[model samples]
Target: MLKNLEYLKSGNEKQRRAFKVINQLNMMEDLKIYSPILCGTIPLSIDTASSDLDIIMEVHDFSGFGDKINFLYGPFPQFKLKRKIIRSKLIVKANFIYDNFEFELFGQAQPVTQQYAYLHMVIEKYLLDTNPSWRCEIIALKERGFKTEQAFCHMLELTGDPYEALINYGLRKQII
Candidate 1:
């Protein structure tokens, strides 16, 4: 987890702002949101200056909740935002100047639940170890056609126990 924090810190100013926005959103109690997958910046190599924030929020429900949440973010007066229902998820796209950020809220979704669980397990086991090599493995997996969330889930699936297969793969690829 420290490495992940470091990864965020290494990002440019806009990425750092995106991270702050995510933190603010997550800290909202009315949203009932959790398990934020801070995707775009950390894993996708999206430059802070050019990329939008991509975040997935796990929620218990999605009925009329997106608009309500969007309204709650009235603090950001200069931003233009839109909320739409996308399947079982509520998608929020907020833009200001040239910067865009997105939030996807998943409600009672099985895939979201599974992914969050897998992410939690993997982070708890591997990320806490502060291994730069493991971080490299994550980066490599992200580079290899896997979505940030998917790659992490795949790593969790492949290793069963954290730091074993992922670290080995990184070492073999000289990414560690």
Candidate 2:
């Protein structure tokens, strides 16, 4: 399912660069790396020029990965990074910024197949195959300040946590 990611290597220069950086990160033998799941507007094909790169990593190890990554990328010629624990999940994440483009690493202590990132990818594939029109609505909703997952729920009039909203939507729509 993720093999289609190879096409992203042909995306614009920035996307290509992001892909390269992600590949480099994946090469770290010590890290329990999962396939880099691309999220945000890029995969939906609704991204604006300013959209940044968002990649999800589901892994089994993160004991000291944050500090290690910080040390390795601290001197990124173009990016400055900040690491923090997401308040809800308490998962450590590192956000990297360079001018208007950004790259984020979300470390999930779960199998990639069991991660929400996998579900989002599934939703994306389902929407792409069966409801491409939703992509436009997503872009419109995003223009109104909703994130991608939020836009998915808002477009379907579902509420609450975006993850739960996705499940509810899948159930209600009989698409799960």
Residue runs of model 1 more than 4 Å from their true location after superposition: 1-15, 23-61, 69-98, 109-130, 149-176
lDDT of 1 at 124: 34
lDDT of 2 by residue, 1-176 (tens): 35345666887666676567656655334343555466666655766566776666664556566666677555554544444555355465666664445766677766555567567656756776787787777777778787777877776677799977886666666665
Every model's Cα RMSD, please?
Answer: 8.5, 3.6
- How do all models score by TM-score? 0.42, 0.73
How many clashes does the backbone of model 1 have? Answer: 0
Which candidate wins on TM-score?
2
Alpha carbon lDDT at 19, candidate 1: 58
For model 1, what is the C-alpha lDDT against the true structure? Answer: 0.47
RMSD of candidate 2 to the true fold? 3.6
List residue ranges in candidate 2 displaced over 4 A. 1-4, 10-17, 20-35, 77-88, 98-100, 171-176
